[model samples]
Target: MLRYYGVDLLDLHRGTLSARRVLVLIRHLPRDSALVRALHGEEADWGAVEHLLAAVVDHLAIGNWLFTSAHGDSEPPRPEPVPRPGDAREEETAATPSPRELAAFFGGL
Candidate 1:
């Protein structure tokens, strides 16, 4: 599929196109079924193609660094905790501070 887009699959495979880069490239993929078939030929299983495409997109969303060069530097993204429905009110309360905020406040001391 990368070849169909005139992108060298070898380059991507060689890590020249980082996982982050593949995601940017995949966003440009043609979404129509007919176009997909045309590119992959008659053997293209729409479901499988869709699944692989989705997997690539998912990896990109997760910020995989597989494509990065040995010299490339990426700061780890700060994670945000998922809020539980049961803690909704506590989450909103000004009296309660999040772990991050509390850490920041005490760390200065």
Candidate 2:
């Protein structure tokens, strides 16, 4: 009896996954556009759902599941380095840009 994130792999393998069961599993997942649609019962393909579960399982096996955010941002979070007692370099804080700078940045794209 294999289980991935508390969902029984037997249900997937047996092709007996129900909408209610899918709803329960999806609710525990991170909030995103596709998930929002699923929550509203907009998408209803059992095979696609099964494929999604398989993909998640594969990702988990590779230990890169949390590397991407719900919004699909590939940039991983960086940990801040701890300064030593006698460090010569000072840590520079990130400055908040003005609205004009923000507009210009997005406008360039």
Candidate 3:
């Protein structure tokens, strides 16, 4: 695609490509205005009809997917956390001695 734009592949990877240099390459395009419009997702100029579709495909390929909820119908709902009941109430009702009481009881023993 860069070659199609008359751009050097090495320049793009080297990060040495200047904005003006890229513009110069784009100017070589037969339909510069139409390429710009396609990149921006707008209607292309009549003169650029042949290459406008390809430009749109190229630009849109860089975007992330945007899908509706219905598209992923198989996804399961997230589960809520459940807390376990503590044993404090059961121990108290059963006359089980507290830690302090048990310590004193054992110390006396």
Tens-digit per-residue lDDT, 1-109, candidate 1: 4444666757777877677766766656664546556666544454565667766776674454444433358755533333322335654676787788888999954
Which lDDT tens digits does candidate 3 get at residues 65-106? 223234665643433222122325556768987788898989
- lDDT order, best first, reads 1, 3, 2
Candidate 2: where are CA atoms >4 Å away? 1-7, 29-93, 97-109
Q: Provide the global lDDT of candidate 3 against the true structure.
A: 0.54
Clashes of 2: 0
Cα lDDT, model 1, residue 106: 96
Candidate 1 clashing pairs?
18-67
Model 1 has an lDDT value of 0.58
lDDT head-to-head 1 vs 3, winner = 1
* lDDT of the structure predicted as candidate 2: 0.54
Q: Give the winner by lDDT.
A: 1
Candidate 1 RMSD to the correct structure: 21.0
Which 10-residue span in candidate 2 carries the lowest summed lDDT?
A: 78-87
Q: In model 3, which range of ten residues has the least summed lDDT? A: 78-87
Sort by TM-score, best first: 1, 3, 2
